[model samples]
Target chain A: MSERIRDFLRRRDDDGPCVVVDLDIVRDNYETFAKALPDTSVYYAVKANPAPEILSLLESLGSSFDCASVGEIEMVLATGASADRISYGNTIKKERDIAKAHAYGVRLFAVDCPEEVEKIARAAPGSRVFCRVLCDGAGAEWPLSRKFGCDPAMAPDVLEHAHRLGLQAYGVSFHVGSQQANLQAWDFALAMAAGVFQEMAVRGIDLKMVNMGGGFPTRYLKDVPGVPSYGAAIFGSLTKHFGNRLPATIIEPGRGMVGNAGLIEAEVVLISKKSEQDEVRWVYLDIGKFHGLAETMDEAIRYPIRTEKDGAETVPCVLAGPTCDSVDVLYEKTPYPLPVSLSIGDKVLIEATGAYTTTYSSVGFNGFAPLASYVI
Target chain B: MSERIRDFLRRRDDDGPCVVVDLDIVRDNYETFAKALPDTSVYYAVKANPAPEILSLLESLGSSFDCASVGEIEMVLATGASADRISYGNTIKKERDIAKAHAYGVRLFAVDCPEEVEKIARAAPGSRVFCRVLCDGAGAEWPLSRKFGCDPAMAPDVLEHAHRLGLQAYGVSFHVGSQQANLQAWDFALAMAAGVFQEMAVRGIDLKMVNMGGGFPTRYLKDVPGVPSYGAAIFGSLTKHFGNRLPATIIEPGRGMVGNAGLIEAEVVLISKKSEQDEVRWVYLDIGKFHGLAETMDEAIRYPIRTEKDGAETVPCVLAGPTCDSVDVLYEKTPYPLPVSLSIGDKVLIEATGAYTTTYSSVGFNGFAPLASYVI
Candidate 1:
C-alpha cells in the first residue's frame, strides 16, 4: 500500500468507506500528459470525477473540460472555469439541454448524426462542431459500442449537413475506447478520423480540428505504460499520417487524468466461508458495485486491492458490496486474492479509484449514503 | 398498448424519459396480496421503490414496511408510518445504525450471524430477531445468492446464542429469491425453516414467527402466476409440514407487490444499424442501466417492452441507454424484437418496472437526470 493511503486510513474518522484523493498526484498526472503532448490541449472529462475541488484544482492548472450534459456544464461553470474551455462531448442530448449549454456559453459541441447536427443548429446556432467517426473500440479494457459516432463514410455528409445548417463543422473526432491498452488502437481510430478529414477535404470542406477522444489508460492491476509512451506513439502516428499538416488538436482525458490519484479506504465488514465444503471465502466490504465501483461489472477493469494483512498466505475470495441485492457481489465472478488472515475492521485500500468512483454512485442505493470523497 | 400508458405518453411534459406510476395499480397490487394471504402480515420492502408518495399511499393502506437502513426508516417515519410496523430486514448493518433504528422504535430485525445478533442484543435489547437460513435460491427468475443468510445447520445454535445474548429469537426467515416463479422453491425454503424451528423447539427456545421473505414474482414478458396460486401452495406446504400449529407469519413483498404498477415512458433517442452490413439495429433510450432499469443487467429480469409501432414488421434490436458508457447497452447481450417502423421520436413503455426502478437510479450519470416518477 502507498504511504499516503496508509496515513489516510490511519487518520480517518468516518465509520465506512470513502475515497481519498491526493491533488498532488492529480497535478503530476496532468503535467505528465501536458509535457508529453505539447500541441494537444487537454479537455478533462468531468463525468469521470465531478468533484468541485478536483475541478477547481484542474481549472487553476488551466485545463479545459469535456462535459456530457447541462448539469456537467453547470458544474464546470460553478468551478469558475471559463465557459469557452467547456466542450459538450456527448453526442446524444436533448434539444433544450443543447440550448441550455449554449446559453451557458459553451461554444464547442460533438455531433455524429444529421438529427443531432440539426438540433445543435437550432439550439446552439452557428457553434463549432466536431463529427465523431465510427470505429469499433479495439484493444481497450472498456470498449464503447454503437451508442455514439456515425460512419466515417457518412461523417463527411454529416459534416456537410452541419455546414448547410449554418454550423461550423470544424473537426473530426473518434474514441479509441476507455482505458485503451494497445497503443495501435490510437493509430486505427486516427486513421479512420483522417479518412473523414480527407473525404471532407475532397468536398471542398477543410476541417480545422481533430478531437482525439479520451482513451488514455490508467494503471490499476496491469502495468500500464507511462503517459510519455502514449504521447510518443500518438505523436509518431500523427506525424506519419499528417506530416506537418496537423489540425488544431484536442485530447479529452477522463480516466487517464484522474484515475490514478484516488484510493478508497474500505473497512472489511465480515469474513466467512460461503459454504462449509467450498474452498473459497467470502469477504464482505462496506463498499460494493452500487457504491461507485460498478465498473467491476464484468471485471473488465480490475482495481488492485491492498489489505492490512499483508505478507500472509493469500486465498481466492468472493468480495461483496454491502447491499441486500444479489447482484451487488463485486468479485464473485472474478474472485480477488485476499489475505487469509484478513478479518473484519481491517482496512482495504482500493487503488486507482478516482476516475469513475464517486460520480457513478447510485443515489442512496439500499439506503446507503453515496460515496464520500476527501481531496487532500 | 395499455390506455393508461398511451394517455401518459400523449401527455408527457418533461423533455427526458420518466417512470409514470399508476397509484391505483399499486393499491390494487397490495390488496391482491393481502386478500390472497389473509393470515400473513404484509411488510412492503422500501428499498424497491422508496418514493415518499408510494410510502404515503401504502401507509394509508395500513401497510407495514421492511427498511434496510436508517434513511429508509426515516422516510417511512416521514410518511406517518409507525416505526413498530417497520422491520429492519438487512442483515449487514453497523451496530450504531442498529441502535439508531431501535431508538426510532423498530423492535424487529433480521440477522443471519451471531455477531449481528450480539450487536442487536446490545443495541436493541429484548427486540424480536429473525435468523435467515442459507439456500442456493434455485428456480427463480432472479435467484439470490448467499449474501444474507446463515447455514441451516447453524441456525439452532445461532438462535440459541441470540437467546443467550438476551435478544428474542422470535422467527426464522428465508428468501425463495426475488421474482420467484417456482411454487416448489417456497416449499423447499419452508421445509428448511421448519427444520430450524424443530431444532429450536428441542432446545426449549420457542420460535413464533416465519418470514417468508420477498420473492413473489411479477408480470414481465412471460406469464407469472397470481398471488392466489402462491398462497395456495404456501398454505398447503405449511399444513403438510406443520399441521395443527402455525407461527404468526409475515411476508415481505417487494417486486411482486409493486412491480406491475409502474411503466417507464422512455423516448427512443436513436436507432441505427451498428455497421453498414450488420443486420442488427441498436435502439438507444433515454434511460438505461445507470438511469433506473439496472435489473436489465445479465437480463435476469426482462421487462416487457411496448413500442408505438406495435403492429409493424418486427426486427431484432439491441436496446441501449443514452450514456457514453459502453456497458450501458441494456439488451445487446440479449436483444429484443422491436418494431422495424419504430422511429427516433417514438416512446417505448417498459412494463412492471414500479419496483427496483427509481430507487436504484444513478444520480446524474453521464449528466442525465434521475428517472422522474409521476404518480397518477
Candidate 2:
C-alpha cells in the first residue's frame, strides 16, 4: 500500500467505518469507456455507486445516466444532468414512480409490459419510450430472457399499444446480462432487436433509438483476460443491420465503468488454526459483506490481497469480516503468498470494489459510516 | 401483506429502491429476548442491525449492547445506554479503537492476543477485560474458533499477561458459532468455559464473569425443528454447570432476537416459464440478493412466502430477485401455493427476514431507497 492509502486507513474516524473510493481512477475509467464508443452515449448506471462525486465525474465525462427510480432521477438531476439524458429503465414500475418520472420531465423510459405501458402512458402521455425485448443467448453468463423484458413475440403488439397511446415509442432495448463471456451475445440480441423494430415498422411504428442495455463485462484480476471489446462489435452489427439509418445508441454500463476502479482497504484482526486442514488461518478484516466486494458471491473472481509492500508472498487465509456473523467471510480459502508475516494492524487492499461498494450500504450499523472518495 | 406494511411500501418516494424495517416488531423482539434471559443481562450484538432505534429499544428493554467497534460504543451511547453496559466484544481490535473505547469510558472489552494485551495496556492502561477462549464445539453454521478467539491451551498465558498489566481481568467469553444446529454444542461450550475459568482461578487470577458469548438459536422456517427453545436447553445447562456461583453471564444474541420478528413485503415482478427445464418456472420478485434475505444463501433456511390470508392455496415457484445477476435467487424450488388468478401486482410476505433484513443492504444501484417500515 502506498503511504497515501495507509494514511487514509489510519485516519478512519473513531465514530464510523468507511469505504474509501478513488475518484482519480474512476475518472480514468470513465475516459477509457468514453474513448471506446465516441458516437454512442454511455448512460452510467447510477445503480453502481450513486455517490454525488461519482455522478459528477460521469457527467464531467459527458456520460448520460440510466435511472430506475425517481430517487435516481433526483440524484442525477441533483448532479445537474439534463432530464433528456436520463432513461427511467425499469420496465415494470409502480404508478407513483411513473408519475414522478413524468413530473421530473424524464423523457426516455423502458417499457416491458402493457401494464407498464399503460402506466407510463397515463402518467407521462407524451414521453419518448423504449420497448425492452427479452433475447436469450444460450451462452451468456446470465440470461435476461423471460424476466425483465418483453418477449420477442410480444414486441409488435407492444409497439402498437405505444402508438395507440400517442407515445413516441422510438427505441428498442435489450440487456445482454452482466459478466457475460460471449460478446456475440450482443450481436445476437441486436440482430433480434432489429428484427423486432422491422416488425414494428411493418405494423406502422417508427423507432428512433436503440439502447443496448448495460451488461458490459469487466475484469478485475490480472490473470483473467480483460473483457472483450463489445463496442466495436456491437457498432459493426448495428450498422450492418440498420444500414446508416441506425438510431442514436445508448449503453448503460455500471460495473464495467466502475467495478475495477475502486479498492477496499482493511486490516487483519487475527489469524487462527482450524484443524489438521493445512492450518486454516482466519484474518478478520475491518470490512464485511456490506462493502461491494461480497457481491462477487455470484462470480468466481477473487481479488488478490496485496500487502503494503506489494509482494506476492502467499499464505492461505480465510478473510472474515468484523461482523460477528460467521457468513461475513469475504473469501473462504483465499491464498495470499506468505514469506512476510501478516500480523494484526497490517493494512491489506481488496481491489476492484469501487462500483457498488459504498452506495449499497444501509449506513445504520452501529455508527459505521460509508466510505468517502477523494480525487487522487 | 398487512395494510400497515403496505403503508410502509407505499410511502416510499419512488426515487430509490430501499429495504423497509418495521421498528414495531423490533421493539417487540427486544422485549422477547430480554424476557427469555430474565436473570441474565442480554448484550444485544451491535453487529446485527445496529440502527440507533434498535439500540434504543434494547436499552429501553433493560438490555445492554455487545459492541465490536468504538463506533458501536458511540452508537449505543447516543441511545443513552451507559458506556459501562457495552462490552467491546471483538476480541481483536485496532490500537486506535482501544484508545477511543478507553477515552469514552468503555471499560469492558475482550482480548484474544498477547500483543493486543500489550497494545491495550499502552492505549487504555486499566481496562476491565475478558479473554476469549476458543471452544471446540463450533458448529457448521459459523465457527468463531477460526478468527477471533484464543485457544484454551493458551488461556493460561493470556490470563498471566493480563494479570501483569494490573487490568481488572473479569472472565472468559466463548462463542459456540452462530446458527449451531447442535443444541448440545452450547452445553459443551459452557463446560469448556467453566474449565477455563477454573484453570484461571488455579493460576491465582480470580474470574468474575464467564460470557458464553451469544449463539442462542432462532427459527428461520416453519417446521424447522432445529431452532430450539432459547430458555430451556442452552441457558438451563449454564445454570446446571455453574450453579449459583456462576459469574455474571453475558449472552450477545444478535440475530436470534430479531430474525423472526420482521418480514419483507415485495411485489411479484415477472412469472416466466423456463424454456430448457420443462417443468421449471421462474417467479421474479422486486427484491434482490443485496437485500438481507441473502442470509438464506448456503443455509437450509427457506424464507417461506405467504399471502395476506395465511393458509392460501399453494403452488410451486422458483423465486428470483430483481437484480440482473442470475445468482440473485431468493429460494430454489419454493412451493408457493398461489391463487389461480394471481397477477403481476400480487403481493408477497417474505417470512423471517426481520433481523438483518433492513440493516444489510446494497443501496448503491439507481436511487434504490431503503424501504420504510411501520411498527404495528
Candidate 3:
C-alpha cells in the first residue's frame, strides 16, 4: 500500500463511497511507460478518466490526448494542454462536432466509413485522418475494437476515399483490445497493419502513421506483463513486420496509464445470506454498478479488493451495489472471495479503479449520488 | 402516433439524438390507471425518470412519490411536493441519508433487513416502515425485486425488529418485477406475501398497508395489456388472498406509468455489412445503452423502434451505439430487423422510452454527451 492510501483510509471511516486517486502512483505509471517506449509518442485516451486532476498531471508531464468527442477535447484543453495535441479518435461523429473540433484546432481524426471520411473532408478540410482496420482482438479482456473498425480489405478503399476527398490519409490504426494481456495479439495486428500498408501502397497511397490503438494491460486481479514487456513486444513486432521501415508510431493507452493509480473506498452496507437454504452470501456495498463500477457487468474486469479484516476465514460471495435495481449486483455470475465475517460499515478498497470508474457512472441511478473522487 | 411526436419529427431533420416526452400521452396513461384503481394510491417511482417536468406533472395530478435517496426527496420537494406524499422506497440507504430524508419530513421508508429497519427507526422514529419480503419476480421482463427483498421466512423477524425499534411496522411490499407480462405472476407473489403476513400476524404485528411494488408492464416491442387488465388481476388476487379485511393499498408504478409517454429520436450513424463474407449487417446509432437505452442489456425490456422507411424491405441487423467501446453495441446477441436502405443521417425512433432513458445515461461515456430530453 502507498502512503497516500494509508492516509486516506485513516480519515475514510465514515466518508461514504469515494475514489481515492494517488498522484504519486499516477505519476509513476505515466513515467514508467515513457521511459520504456522512447520511439513511440503517448496520447492518453481521455474517455477512461477525464478528471481534471489526472489530465493536468499528464499535461504537466507533456502528454498528448486521444479524444472521442468534443467533451474530451474541452476537458484536455481546459487542463492547459494544447489543442494540437488532441486527436478525435471516434470514427462515428456528428458533422457539427467535426467542424467544431476542427475549429478548435484539432488536426487528426479517425474514420472507418466513406460517409464519415467525406464528412470530415467537408467539415474539416485537409485535416490529417487515420483509417482503423478490423482487429479480431482475441486474447483480450475487453474486445473494444469490434465497434470501431472496418474490414481490412476496405482500408485501401477508405484511404483512397480520404485522398479523393482532399483529406490527408495519414495513417492506419487498430486496437488489439482493452487490457490486452497476450503479446502475440500485437504481433498479429501489426502484421495485419503491414498488409493494409502494402495494399495502400499498391493504390499509390503511402500511409505515414501506424496507430497502435489502446489495449495496454493494467494489473488488476490477474497478473500482467509490465510496461517494458509490452514495449519490447510492440517494438519487436514493428521491426519484424515493417522490416526496417516503420511509420510514425502512435500508442494510445487509457487503462494502462491510469488504472493502477486509483482505488475506490466503499463501505460494506450489508452482508446477508440471500436465503436460509442458499449457501452463497451476498455482500452489498455502498457503491454499485450504477455509481461507478459499471465495468463489472459481465465480470469482464475483476477488480482486486482488499479489506481490513485479513487472515480471517474467507468465503465466496456475490458482490452487489447499493441500489434498488437487481442488475446492480457486481459479481453474481462469478462469485467473489470475501471474508465470511465481513459486516456493515467495514470498508473495502477496490483497487485499480482509476480508469473506468468515474466516467461510466450513471448520472443518478436509483437517486443514489454518483461516485465522488479525490486526488491526493 | 401523437401530434406531439409528429410535430417533433417533422422539424427534427438532421437533429441529433433526443428524447421527446409528450405530456398528453403521460396524462392519458395516468388517467387510465387512476380510473382503473380508484382503491389504490399511486406513488410514482422517481428513479424511472426523474425529469422535473414529469415530477411536476405527477405532482399536479396528486400522485405521490417513491424515492430511493435524499436526492430524489429533494427533487420532489423542489417540485413543490409535500413531504407526506413521498416514500423513501429503497431498502438500502446510508445513515446520513436516512437522517437527511427524515429531516426533510419524509415519514415512509422501506426495509428488508433488521439493521436498516433499526437505522430508520432511529433516524425517523415512528415512521411508516414497510418490510419487503423476498420475491423471485418470475415472468417479468426485468426481475428487479430480488435485490431489495428479504426471504419470506425472515420477513417476520424484520418486521418484528421494526416494531421493536419503535417503527410503525406499517406494511409489507413485493414487486412482481418491472414489465411483468403475465397476470398469473401477481397471484403467486401475493400468495407469497400472504405467508409473510400470516407469520407477522402470528407475531401479533398487524400490517396496515400492502405495497404492490412496480411491475406493471408498458407497451414496448411486445404488446402489453392496458392498466385495467393489471388492476383486474390484482384486485382478483387481493380478494382471493386477503378476504374482506384488506390493508390500504399502494402501487408504485415506474415503467408502467411513463414508458409509453416518451420516444427517442436517434440518427443512424452507420449501416455496414460486418465484412465481405459475413452475413450480419451492423447499424450504428447516435443513442445507445450508455445514453439511456440501458434496459436493452441482456435483451430485457426491448423498446420498439420505428423509422420513416416503415414499408421498406427489412433485414436483421446488429445495432450499435456511436462510441468506440465494444460494449456500446446495442443489439448484437439479439438482432433487430431494420430497413435495408437505412443509411447515414436517417433517423430511428425508439418508442416507449420514457421510464429508464435519461436517468440511466452515463454522465459522459466516451466523451459522448448524456441524453437530452424535451417535453412536447
The TM-score leader among the candidates is: 3
In candidate 3, what are the lDDT values of residues A1-376, reduced to their tens digit?
5777879778765566888788888788888878888878889999889889889999999888999888899999999888888989998888888999999999899988787898899999999999988898898888763677788988888889999989998989999988989999999999988998888888898888988988888898779988899889989999999998888988899998888888998988777664567778778898988988999988788998999886799998889988878788888877898887787778898989988888799888887767888888
Residue lDDT tens for model 1, A1-376: 4577668778877777899888888899889889999989999999998888889999999899999888889989998888999999988777777889989889899888787888899999999999987778888877777677877777888899999999998999898888888899888877777777788889889999989988999898889878899999999888877778988888999889889889988888767663356687888888998888988887777889988788999999999898888788888776899998897668898999998888788888888888888887
What TM-score goes with each of the models?
0.94, 0.84, 0.96
CA error at residue A123 for candidate 3, angstroms: 2.1
- On DockQ, the candidate that comes out on top is 3
All candidates: DockQ: 0.53, 0.34, 0.61
lDDT of 1 by residue, B152-251 (tens): 8878877898999888999898898888889999898888888888999999999999999889988888898889999999988888777778888889
True-structure RMSD, every candidate: 2.5, 4.6, 2.1
| Better by DockQ, candidate 3 or 2 | 3
Measured over the true interface residues after superposition, the C-alpha RMSD of each candidate is 2.1, 4.2, 2.0
Q: Candidate 1's interface RMSD, please?
A: 2.1
Better of 2 and 3 by lDDT: 3
Predict model 2's lDDT versus the native: 0.69
Worst 10 residues of 2 chain B by lDDT: B220-229
